[model samples]
Structures are given as C-alpha cells and as structure tokens.
Target chain A: MQTEQITETQKENKKQSTWRTAVSALLIFIAVPATIYLGWKFADRQHYIVSLLIILYSMVPFFLMYEKRKPQARELVVIAVMCAIAVVSRAAFIWAPHFKPMTAIVMITGIAFGATAGFLTGAVSGFVSNFIFGQGVWTPWQMFAAGIAGFLAGILMHKGILKKKRLHLCIFGGLTVMLIVGPLLDTSALFTMASGISWESARLIYLSGLPVNAIHATATVLTLFFFSKPMLEKLDRIKLKYGMMGD
Target chain B: MDDAFSGYHPAVNFIFFIGAIVFGMFFTHSAFLCASVFTSMLYYLLLMGRKGIKLLCTMLMLFFALSFINPLLNTQGDTVLFTYIGERPFTLEALMYGFVTGGMFVSVLLWFACYNCIMTSDKFIYLFGWCIPTISLLLSMVLRMVPNFKVKIMTIAGARKCVGKAPVNGDKKEKLQNSMDMLSVLTSWALEGAVVTADSMRSRGYGSGKQSNFSIYRPSVRDMAAGIIMLFCIVLTIICAALGGMEVAYFPVFILPEANIITILGVIGYTAFLLLPSIIHIWEEATWNILRSRI
Candidate 1:
C-alpha cells in the first residue's frame, strides 16, 4: 500500500511538471511571437512601446517558471544575496563609469546557482541599482541585457562550454558583454532617443556605443579573471553547508 | 518639502506617471512636445529644488547634442540647410525632427526623475505585490539585501583596515586586486549569513501558505477625485490622438497639425495632466502660507 501511494504521488508530480513545461513552452514559442507580431502590426511607428512589450513578454516565461517551482526561502535568499552583491559592487565602482563588476558578478551567480537564479540576480540588480543611478527609459533594457547575460552564462556553464577557469570565464564574459549586452543597450538608445530608424541612425548609435561597450567588456573580463574562482568556491561552500540550491 | 501629489494613492501616482511618460514618448507634435518638456522641467524643479538645476543643465546639453547629431545622420528631408563631407546634405526638416525627438527624450527623463522622487520602493511593491507576490517578495528581499550587504562590506573593510590590509592606497592594478579580495571576503560572509537568514525565514513559516502583504496606503476621497480627473484627461487626450488631432509629419517636409478644436482640447488635456502635480504643490504651499499667517 505504501509503495502504491508513493507511485501515485510520483505520477501526480510528473503530471504537474509536464503541465508546467507545456505552459512555459507555449508562452515562449507562441505568446512571445504573437506579441511581437501584433505589436509590430499595430504600433509600427512606436518602436519604444513595441520593443518594451516584446521584452516584457519574453521575460514572462522565466518568472512564471520560477513562481511555479515554489522555491524555498534559502533559494530566494541566495538569489537576493547575489542581486545585492551586484548592486553594491556597481555602487562601489561608481567613480569609474562603464567599469562595473556587476555583469561579472551576475555571471558568477549564474555559473554557481543556475540559470534562473542568475537571471533573477541580473534583473534585480539592474532594477535596484537604478534606484541609486536614477531610473530611466534604459532600465528595462539594462535588465534584459544583464538577465540574458546571466542566462547565457548559466547555459554555457551547464553545457561545459564555459569552464570555471579564469581564462575561459574571462573570454566568455568579454564576448557576452561586447556582443550581447552592449548591442542590446545600444538598441534601446536607438529606439528611445533616435529620431528615425534609418540605417544611418542605427549605425551611428551602434558606433557611438562601441567605446562604452569596450570599457564595460574590459571590466567584466578583469572581474571574472580575478574574482570568479573564490566567488564560485564560496557559493559552492554555501550550497554544500546548507544543502540548498542544488537544483 | 512634502509633495501633495505624492500623498495621493500609489495607483494614482503610478497612473499619472504612466500617462505623462507614455504621452511624452509617443507624441511628436511640437506643441505637445513643448508642453511636455516645459511641465516636466517645472515638476522636476518643484520636486528637486535647487539641486535639480545641475541635472537640468546636463539635460539641456544632451538635448542640443542629440538635436545636432540627428540632422547629420538623417539626410532625408527636402530643405537642405548645408552640405557636409561626402555630400551629406543637412536638412532643416531633420533638424526640426531632431529637436522634437530630443525634447521628448528630455521630458521623459525629467518625468522619470520626478517619478523616482514620488514613487518610493515601498509604494511600488505595494502596488504590484498582490498581483505578483513572488516577484514582489523577491524585489523587496533584494532591496533589503542591497543596503544590508553595503553595510556589511563597510564593516568588513573596516575590520580589514584594523589589520592594516584595507585597499585604501595603491597603484591601479594593486587597488583592483585588493578590492577583488575584499569582494571575495564579503561574498563568503554574505553567503554564510544568507543561510541563517533563510533558515530564520523558514522558521517563520514563510512558504507554508499564501503570503500576506501589509501596506499603509489607503485611498481616500481626495485620491478618488484625483484619479477621476486624471482618467478624464488621459481618456480625452487619447481620444483626440486617435481622431488624428495630434497628427504630425516630419519626413521630406515638416507639417504641424491645424489648430482645430479637437487638437486644442487634446493639447489642453495633455498640458493639464502634466501640470497636475506642480499645480497641487503650488496650491498646497499657498494654503499652508495662509493658514500659517492666520495662526
């Protein structure tokens, strides 16, 4: 009878997990594209609104998945701690514009905890830091860029393509910031501040962002080179001591 | 000084800002842009006082820079003001478009500055907590942790200083290394403390059932009145915009909308909405002065 009950509970858990998987897939594959299509169709000229909606929609699946998991308090605390570190580090380095260890710390969180935790750390850091730096139209874009960086870091680490070594992590961090986060933010500048969406204006925006992106990328690479090992070890120690955030 | 507008319900504050920012972003008509930039500057000044002047000057610089750059990049207009290198003709239409765009961007920035002052974090959490409990809880936790970590880091640095190991003075690379060491130490301390915090939270039955949120905000009759007025203005302006009353064209030629009744009403609505907070503050100041004099 005990064995039967255990199997029954397992079956129920399996069903719930499958349902969640389906819902997340639907949100990502169907809802996101539908939103982009409709937003483009109706709000052709309103680039800011359209892009903002697309970002908000794309983020829904991650939040939904996280909420559905019913994460433990320890898990939440770990994510919060990562976010706080990112924000604090950004604040600590305020004198050096574009040279923030925030992205590097966020990537470490991803490499240590997992993708979801990493994303949350990045997004929350982007948001809370804006409280100090002053929120603007760039807030959402910054959040999205950082979150994606964390997400990619988590995925690559999980796939073994991104090793924990200093050289590997530094290269990954530099490339991610320059290729992904930088362009995403520059795109926001184009959509929000630029008058028109011509190729010329877009090129100008991207070119203007290059110097800032280079500085940011250098910061990330330096941070990862010096800090990733000890930070990862510390995170591993916490997980081992508390036996939490293993998943 | 306390802002009278901020005393309203959080929803009212959020609605007003959303309206102001959205309209400011979407509208490109020169009249509407002028109203937006002017009112946003006024409200920002009211919110920030003299400290805002420096930022306003920076914003003006940004506005001029953006306005100047736009004509150089976009050479699509008919009226050529001048030709630069590579036969790139700078057009008057592009310059005007640039000015309108720059005005919109600056106004949005100013409105956001005012919003940062008015809508504090607790209010933001209160407004969204019920609908998104998990995210809101996470947001609050992160916000709580940021300051906590800052204090902890300072303490750690102080402790390090007592040991003569603080990163106070060094060459650039050495300073970077010292800071990184400090960060690593802080991370370990923070992570260890976090486990205790999580355990304490768990002991308090945090995830046992649906969590309850507490807030001090309660909408009153005055808030209701403010909400109604804001909604009426927003709806009127949106309707006017939908009816093509706020239409503007910039490419190839510049065309401003005719001064029709609907367009005028839309502009008035837009201006009134943007000016609401400043008006409330000014009125409150006057009333306070009168009451003080009587007293």
Candidate 2:
C-alpha cells in the first residue's frame, strides 16, 4: 500500500512538472516575442514604456515558477539573507566609487542556491538598496540587469561550465557584468534620456558607458577572486546543516 | 509642515503619481513641460524644504549638461545656429528638443523624489502584497534583514577590534583582505541565524494556511473625491494627447500645435493634476491658521 501511494504521488508530481514546463515554454517562445512585436509596431516613439513592459513580462515566468514550488520558510529566509548581504556590502563599499560586491554576492547566491532564488536575491537587493540610495527612472532596468546576472550565474553553474574555482567564477562574473548588466543599463539611458534614437546616439551612449562598465566588471572579478572560495564553503556548510535549498 | 496629500489612501497617492509621471514622460509640448517642471519643483520643495536645495541644484546642473549634449550628438535640424568641429551644425530646433527632453527628465525625477517621501515601505507592501504575495513577503523579509545584518556587522567588528584583528591604516590589499574576512564571518553568522528564524516562523504556523495582510490605510471620502478628480484629469489629458492637441515636432523643423480651446484645456488639466498635492497642502495650512486664530 505504501509503495502504491508513493508511485501515485510521483506520477502527480511528474504531471505538475510537465504542465509547468509547457507554460514556461509558451511564455518564453510565444508571449515574449509577441510583446516585442506589438510594442515595436504600436509604440514606436514610446520605447521607454515598451522596454519597461518587456522587462516586467520577462520576470513573470520566474516568479510563477518560484511561487508554484511552495518554498519553505527556511528557503525564503536564506534568500532574504543573501539579498541583505548584497545591499549591506554595497553600502560598505561606498568609499570606493564603482566598486561594489553586489554582483559577486548575487552570483555566489546563484551558485549555492538555484536560478530562481538567485534572481530574487538580485532583484530584491537592486530594489531595496535603491530605497537607501534614492530611487530613480533607472530602477527597473537595474533590477532586471542584476536579476539576469544572478540567473545566468545559476544556469552556468548548473551546466557545469562554471565551477567553484576562483578563476572560473571571476571570469564569469566579470564577463556577465561587462556584457549583460552594463549594456542593459546603457540601453535604459539611451531610451529615456536621448532626444531621439539614432545609431550615432546609441553609439555615443554605449561608448560613454564603457569606462563605468569596465570598473564595475573589475569590481566583480576582484570580489570573486578574493572571496568566492570562503563564501562558497560557508554556504555549503549551511546547506548541509539545514538541508534547505537542496536543489 | 506635514503635507495633507500624503495622508490620503495609498491608492490615491499611487494613481496621482502614475498619472503625473506618465504624462510628464509622454508630453513634449512647451506648455505641458512647463506645467510639469514647475509643479514638480513646487511639490518637491514643499516635501523636502531646505534639504532639497542641494539635490535641486544638482538636477539643474544635470539638466543643463543633458540639454547641451543633445545638440552635439543630434545634427538633424535645418536651422543652423553655428558650425562646430567637423562642421557639425548646431540647430535651433535640436536645442529646443534638448530643452524639452531635459525638462521631461528632470520633472520625472522630481516627482520620484516626492514619491519616495510619500510612499513609505509599508504603503508599498500594502499596495503590492495582494498581487504578488511571495515577492512581497520576500521584500519585507529582506527589508527586515538589512538592518539586522548591519547591527550584527557592527557587533562583529567591535569584537574583532577587541581581538586586534580590526582593519587599521594598512595597504590596499590588507584592507581588502580584512573586509573580506569580516564579510565571510558575517555571512556564516547570518546564515546560521536565518535557519533559526525560519524554524521559528514555521513553528508559528507560517504556510499552514492562507495568509492575511494588515494595513493601516483605508480610503476615505476625501480620497474618493481626490481619486475622481485625478481620474477625470488623467482621462482628459490622455484624450487630448490622442487627439494631437499636445503635439510638437522638432526634427528637420520645429512645429507647435496651434493654440485652441482643446489645447488650452489639456494644459489646464495637466497643470491641475500636477498641482493637486500642493493645493491640498496650502489649503490645509490656511484652514489650520484660521482655526488657530479663532482659538
């Protein structure tokens, strides 16, 4: 009887997983492209609104997946602790301009936890920190960028492409910031502040942002190089002790 | 000095700000821009008083810098004001476009500043909790954890100082190592504490049933009135924009809408929406003074 009940529960879990997969696939493959097409077709002049909507919509699938899992209170607390650490570390490095451990910390959370948790940690930190640093038009874009960084970190680690080694983690962290987060922020500035969107203006905006991106990338790389080992070990110990977030 | 507008329902506050910010972003007409910037400045001053002056000045500098940068990058207009390096023609139309864009940017920023002052964290959570409960709970948890971690870090640092491991006037690498050690220690301590917090929450029956939220805000009759007025103004302005009453073009040549009744009314509606908060505050102050005089 117990064996039969276990099989039935496993089948139910499989069904739910398939359903989730279908929904996520549909959202990514159809809904995202539809939003982009409609946005560009109708709101040509209002790129800011269109881009903002795209970012918001892209985040929905992750949130839905996280909610469906019914995470335990311990898992929620762990994610919250990671976010707080990211925010506090940002504050702690205020004396050094463009030198923040936020991205590295988010990436470490991703490596230790999973993608959804990583994204939540990054997104929440991006948001709550702005309450202290002052909210602005760039808040949504910043949130999206930071969340994507953590998401990518989680993905790479899961795929075994990104190891726990210091060099490997540092390279991934640096490249992600330079290629992803930095450009996303510059794109926000381009759409919002620029009088007109042109190839020349876009080039100027990206070019102007390059130096800042380099500094940010360097910060991420340095943070990972110096701290990833100890942080990962600490996180592993907690995971073992609590048996929480065991993906 | 407390603003009367902030005392309204969060829904009212949220709607008013969304209307102000969206219209401020979309409209490029001189009248709309002027109304937005002027009213936002007034409200920001009312909210922040003397402390706002420094940020206001910084925004002013940013506005000028942005305005100047636009003409340099965009050489689109026909009316050449001057020729610069590489024969880049600085045009009158582009300059005007820059000013409008800069004005829109600054006004939106000012409105956000006022928003920060009015929309406290609890108000934000109250508004969003129902829509996204998990994320909202996470936000609340993170907010709660940030101050806790800060206190813990201080305690740890103090303890480390007692043990002679505190960071001193050292080289860059030494300082970096010291900070990293502090962070690692903080992380371990926080994670350990977090497991206990989670267990405590579970013991308190979290996730055992549907959750109920408690909020102090309730929409009153005045909030309803304010909401109705704001909705009417927003609808009016949006209709005006859709009808091209607020249209302006500044590409090859500058174009402005002919001043008609609809355009005038649109501008008035926009101004009224933006000025609602300041008006409420001033009116409340006047009433209080009258009552105090009678007393």
Candidate 3:
C-alpha cells in the first residue's frame, strides 16, 4: 500500500514482455535444474538438507524482484485463504490416497492472482498441511515442488496461454504435476533412503513411483479440467467486487 | 482433550520436540529410531487414548510400504533378496535402510502430532509471535481458518442438499455447476469476514502500537530444572553421536552397531531425551490419580 508505482510493473510482467518471459523460462528450465544437479553432485553426504534448502532459498529473490508493490492487507488475506483452501481441498479427498485438489488449486491461484501469490500459496500449503499430515524431512522438498509448479503457472498466465483455453490449462497443470512434482518427490525419497545415490537409482525411483505419480497427475487434470474455469471466474469476481488484490 | 502438559512451560515442549524430531532425523541408530516411534505412540496413547490407534495404523502402513519400496528402487548392497519385476535385485541393505528411514519418518510425525497438542496454534503463536509477527500471525490465522472453513463448506453442502442441488448427488455436469456455486459462496463469505477482521485489527492499532503480550505460562522451578536436564542430556547425546558410536552402517554392507560402554551411554541418553514427554505424562497421571484417591 505504501508503494503504488510497483504494481504497474508487476502487471506488465504478468503480460510477460519478451525478456521477462525468457527469464521466467530460464528460472524453471535452467536455474532450478542446475541447482538440483549441483546439490546432488556436491552435497552427497547431506544432500537431503542441502538440495532442499537451495531450492527453497532460490524462491526468495524471485518474490522480491517480481513484486511491484507490497501486497495489500486484503491481498495477503487472499493468498492465505487460497493456501487454506488448497490444504482443505486435500482433506476432502482423504478417502482416496492420491486423488487431491491441491495442485489444481495452486495453479489456479497463480493463473488468477499472480506468480508471487501462487508460489506463496503453494509453499504455505506444503508446510501447514504437513503439520496436519505430519512434518518430516520431506517437508522442504514438497514445499519447493509445489511452489515451482505455481510459479510456472504464473508464467503460463503471463504468456496468455493458460487463459487461451480450458484444455491448455488442464494440459499444463497435468504435465507439471506428472513430470516435475512426481520426480521431485521421488528424488527426495531416494536421497533419504538410498545409501549411495546415483542417477540410475533416481531413474528407478521414478519408475517405481510411476503408479502413484500417474494417479496424482490424472487427479490434477481431472480437477483442473473440471474446476479451474469456474474457480478462476469466482476469484476474478471477488477481486473486482471487493476492490481487493489491486485488480 | 485430556491435556497432560497444559500447564508446562512452552520452552519445555519446544526443547523436547527439537530433541525428538532432530534426533529422529539425524541418528540412524535402529534402537534410537524404535525408541522414538514407540515412546511417541505411547505418549499419544497416554494423552489421546484410543483416538491414537488410527494414527498408529497409518504409521504402520508407512513403515511397511517404505521398507518394501526402498529395496525395489535401490540396487546396492552385498546380500541380495529376490529380484523385482525386472533385473533390479532387492537388496537386504536397502531394505534395512528403508526400515530405519520409515521409522525416522513415523517418529518425526508422531512427535509433531504430540506437538500440535502440546503447543497449540495459540501457544505456537505465543512462542514466536513477537519475533516473526507477520508469518506467525498468518500461520495462526490459516490454522484457525482451515478447520472452520471445512465446517462452513459442509454446512453449505447440506444446505444445497435441501434444494436438491447437492454436489455429491448431482450428475457430473450438475455437480460441477453446483460445486462452483458453493465455491463462489465460500469466497464471498470469506472476503466479508476478512474485511471485518482487517477492521478489527486496525481498530486495535495492530500496526502502530508497541505490542505488549500477556502470557499465562510462568516457568516454575520444576520447569527450570527439567529444562536444565534436557539441555545436558542433548549435549551428551550429541557428543556420543559425533563420536561415531550410536549408528550402524546401512549401505554396501549392513553392519550392526557395536554395543559398548559409549554406545550404551548414548542409548540411555537417547532414550531419556525421546521419553521426556511420556515420562512427564506418566508422572502427572500417577500423581493426579493419587490425589483423586486421597480426596
């Protein structure tokens, strides 16, 4: 609220001018993957903590640089509410193990709100829900995995791709969950359990974890394909009617 | 809600969890991990009674699944069990590591469950509220709001049922439309509440005042003494653990830990640290029972 000028830049970034879009793409495809490989190659003895913290901390600068204005109080509440909804969405599907609304809710938050909001929602949901499900060494890994997906959703929104059609949104959401989230989780499982970690073992971990990952991906697509348009429309209307989110 | 440690200092709860969760994650000692899991479950049972059996069942599933999965993914180790669906040999070492890791995860989860009871959302905010005011406040709000939101959604779902518009019972298309309507209702309701909350917070000078907090927990002499003991025990355990006496090797070969004077001392220290809550609960329960009998 104190600073009003920054919002213009952030909204512009949302449209994702060429350089900014390139930077966003680099963040996912290059920066993150390189960090993972480095953490794996260097911190072999304690890569569990090392890699997780590296990925988590990498998120901070993006949040700082991307913010055009300080998030308004109401905007902060929106983010928190989105996070609460994401976690609560998990509870609704408790009977079914891998079927969850979390990833879809997160991506929608990004597409509707912005990158920072989406990332925060994902990271917070990962953490606070872990408190409900129980926290463990896997917490940081989950936090980053979810946050990255939301960040990419922001990029998707900026490129005008997510809103292009409902089908594209569902496709992007499903692929991100299936490819990124699953592999990140499986790698963490490998690092925690395996004595000597290697690329082959990482691949096998992915292979073995394929069954659960598929279910998770399918669940993501099902929720997004069905729910995203309606949810985003509601969120947009709320933003307009309440004069919240500086929309 | 039989809160055994309700009156205890928050620091005691904080220190105990740091010890349990950190040690549970850190040391690979089978004895210590088992102790962490066992005592945490026992503590849960003591505090929450039969409500804990379901949690125990979940923990058991996690434990077994982990043990089974690890051997399949991992192809290391000298002694190999039967091969998997393919050429991947199921190694005993991998299985052992999985067992230990699963134990660690369960132990951490149980300790956190106890933590959610001991250090409630209010108490947790109290502990860190002043330091990280913003994040702590948000966390407290989310924690409180999530369960409340669930109830409200359930009520909305029920109300929809009366109108023959239940999300659950509708055809796929109708269900989607019905659920979206309820979701919109929820968002609007939440925003109205948020506005009121922001107003209330502003009225309290939330941003302007030098906030002074009032806490009911006064650390008694008993708390101080227990805190000192816990500190000493943690230090001793760390020293022993650093000396390479607490855990066995689980890779390339599953070598059992050597049992000697140092390892035994380490085990005792580890046991004591993990058992802090359970021992306190038993002591409290016994004393309370005695007091009731005398009365």
Candidate 4:
C-alpha cells in the first residue's frame, strides 16, 4: 500500500511537470514567431514595438543572473540621463566642425558610472539622436556602436586601462577604436542606406570621411581635457553635499 | 560584484548585441515594401497561423487605409491613383505604390522592434568594453544620467510652476532661457558630481597601473556555438542583401513583388535566423525547469 501511494504521487508530479513544460514551450514558440511577424509587418509605422522589445529584452539577462535586483527608480533615472545626453551629443555631431567626437564623452560618462549606465548612455544617445535626425535601420547600428564605445570606456576605466589625466591615452585609445571598429559600423550604415554601393566603394566613402572622423576624435579629447578637472571638482562637492560617498 | 548587476557575461552580450545591430543595418532601402510584407507575414504567422487568411484580410484593410491616405497627402508619385480635390489627380499606380510603401514602412519599424528585443544595450557594452574603455564608460554614465537629468528637469519645472513663474511653454526666447536655466543647474550638478568621482577614483588608486582586475565572464561552449551561428547568419544575410536579393526600388519601377521566390526565400531566411536563439533559449529553459520540477 505504501509503495502504491508513492508511485501515484510520483506519477502526479511528473504529469504536472510535463504539462507545465509543454505550456511554457508552446508559449515561447507562439510569442517568438508572433513578435517577429508582427514586428516585420508594422516595422515601418510602429517601430516603437521593436524598441519596446529591445528594452524588455535587456531585462532578460539581468533577470536571469540576479533574482533580487529589480529595475528601480534610481536606475531609471540614469537611463533617462544617458538618453538625453546621447541625443544632445548626436545633435552636436551635426554642428561640429566635422562631427564632434562623442565616443570619448560617452566613455567618460560610463567610466564615472557603471556598465549598465555606460551602455544605456551610448545606446540611448544613438537611438534618440537618430529618431530626431533620421529613422532608418542604421539607427540601431549607431546605438550599438556608440553604446559599445561607452561600455568599453567603463570596463577599461574600471580595469585601470583608461585614466582621466592621460588625455593622449584616451585619444589614442579612442582613435584606435574608431579606425578598426568604426569601419564596420560605417559599412553597416552604408549598406543599409545605399545598398547598391559596393563594399569597396563604401570603404572609400568611409575613408574619405576621415576628416570628420578626426574632428570627432579631436573634439572628444579637447572636451574631456577641458571639462574633466572642473567636473571632478564639482562631483566632489556633490558627494560632500549628498554624503553619498565617504571621504 | 557588489550585486548591482547579475553575473551575465558582458562579453557574450556584446557579441550578440553587435551582431543584432549589424543585422539591422541590412534593411535600409526597401524600408516600406520589405516592412509591409514582413509585418503581414509576421501578423499572420504569429497570430493566425494556417488561418492566416483572416489576418491577410485585416492586413489588406490596413494597407488600403495607409495607401489611400498616403497619396492624398504625399502626392509625389508619377502614376495617378485618383482625383482627390479636382486638380489633384491620384494615379492608380501611385496609390498602389503608396500602399506598398506604407506597408514597407510599417514592416521595417516592426522588424526593428524585434531586433531590439533580441539585441540589447547590455550586449553592446559587453562586446566592445575591452577595446574602448573611456567611450564605453561614458555611455554607461550617460544611460544613468539621462534619467537623472529628466528628474531634475521635472522637479525644477514643477517648482517653477508652483512659484507662479511656469516655464513650460513660450516663444523661442523663453524656451531658450528655460533651457539655459536647466543647463546651469545641470552644469553645477555635473561639476559637483565630477569632483566626487575623481576623489573616489584617486582614493581607489585608479591610475596606479596595478593591472586592476575585472570579473571577466568567459564564454561557455554554448555561448560560443550561439555566437558562431549568429555570425554565419549575419554574413549570409549581408551577402544576400548586397546582391539585391532584398531590394525593391520604386518610382522608376517596382521589382520583386512578394510572390518572387528569391525575395520570399531571403525574407524567410533572415527572419528565421534572426529569431533563432531566443526561440531555442526559451525552449531549453522550459524543458530544464520541467525536469527540475519533476526531480
């Protein structure tokens, strides 16, 4: 009688588990295809859905890794700030003698903050700016590239690879980033915008745009050099006022 | 490490994240047409399935609305769809074109939405963090800062309103002044923030060049496999995209209708690969949980 009861209980548990698995799997399959198809159809008119999805997707890895740290008020504030700066910076790019180098600014901000903060700044800046300037597939690339740049700065700063005072170090690092990785982003944008242009031609176009690229690098370094000291001083004052960080 | 973020490896996130963006960059020209077809198929496949015929009908309704409204407003096409206000002749070709273009436009936006869902900001940072530190750091800061700035603006704006000197709406000058005021406040705050950060860094021996350590998240075998698949898909997509497999230029001519096999194949291949990982992960997780529960 005891053996029978145990078997019965085990069977019930297995049945329930199977049911749950099937339901979850079905839901995922349904959700994935539905999103892609719906997203594909309304992609032009209602691109917000995609952006919404991306924002939601970001929470996935976060959720998977940590059960306790929920998205919060303070964190939301940071996301908003990064977005605004990104927009402003992109707009500023249009006005710069060439294009105001923004990677440095984003990098600096990320270093000061943390990883998520840095990534958001770059991503948001690219996103907001693109929305204002143009609405194309290239916008996502910009967001990713710019965001990556900022995120890199944060990680390196954390690791002591990048320093505040070493303007040359920052500039060289920023330039190297642009020269190697920048091309891929440039090519991506070009391919999307003007697909007819051969990859070779696209490379030439990007190469020709070197002046603008240089300006971007120079502007970034100069801005950092001029602002870092004052900014640090002010940050110190804020820390004192808020007592957020101990001396 | 201190519990600010989960232990998800930034490196894997970055790789996939960039891959996603690169994927997105493949869809620039056919914006309207491609988006339209993709969205229709998406809605039908995801929602209606074999009964997608009903969804297609709904899609037609949407297409009619967009195309009809578009030419009436845009009036750029050479072929007239109809006569709107007497002198304004809307050509049939134009209306149809508009309809297709509108569909494309909508579809492209939807595709981006899906792309965003798959590739996120976290992934972007993780991939590129090592190569470009300062920029990456600043980006993160900006992400955090944008929200901060918004709060400050709202608070200041609210306080001003309460004082009966509301600075919400006005002419350019007033708006400029309001912005200037905001900038002043922001600058003051930023300066203060900078000082604190520098002090913190200095104390932490940031520039000490002691080969500071970072909690690197090495890619697991699964992650590597996933990365390889993503890279391969992107490469194939680019090649196809470059060969005009996806291009459908309007005005002079409208080539490659949805019925075209090559175009259909490209669309299918791209969509399938794009959504592959998420599908697999979701499936695997469900299975794992079920087995665990059973145990």
Tell me, by lDDT, which candidate is best: 1
lDDT (10s digit) by residue, model 1, range A4-122: 87687567656766776787788778887886675454332478666766786677677767766778899888888888889898644533566799999999999998888788788
Per-residue lDDT tens digits of candidate 1, residues B1-295? 5999999999999999988987787787888889999999999998889999999999999999989988987888899988989898999998998898789889999999999999999999999886557778989988888888888878877887786666664677776777788888778888888889889999998976557786999999999999999999999898888787877778879888569999999999989998999999999989999999997
Q: Report how far off residue B2 is in candidate 1 (Å).
A: 0.6
Work out the TM-score per prediction.
0.92, 0.92, 0.78, 0.44
Q: Lowest lDDT 10-mer window, candidate 2 chain B?
A: B163-172
Return whichever of 1 and 4 wins on lDDT: 1
- What DockQ, between 0 and 1, does each candidate earn? 0.55, 0.54, 0.23, 0.06
Tell me the spans in candidate 3 whose CA falls farther than 4 Å from its real position. Answer: A1-71, A90-99, A136-138, A155-165, A192-204, A237-243, B50-99, B209-216, B250-261
Per-residue accuracy of model 2 over A103-133 as CA lDDT, tens digit each? 8999999999978888988888999998887
For candidate 2, give the DockQ.
0.54
lDDT by residue (tens digit), candidate 3, B1-295: 6665656788888888867876666667777677788888888788778888998998899888877776766677989877757667888898887787677667777887887777665666678655444555567778878998888788878898898977666576676556656665666677668777766776766645234453677889988988888888898787787676765777799887669877888888878877777787788889999999998
Instruction: Give model 1 RMSD, 1 decimal.
Output: 3.6
Relative to the true structure, how large is the alpha-carbon lDDT of every model?
0.85, 0.85, 0.73, 0.51
lDDT per residue (tens digit) for residues B177-269 in model 2: 777788888898998888999999999988765666758888889999999999888888877777778767787899885899889989888
Model 3 score (lDDT): 0.73
The residue-by-residue lDDT of candidate 4 on A17-77, one tens digit each, is 5554554455456655676675565332223344434433443232222112222223333
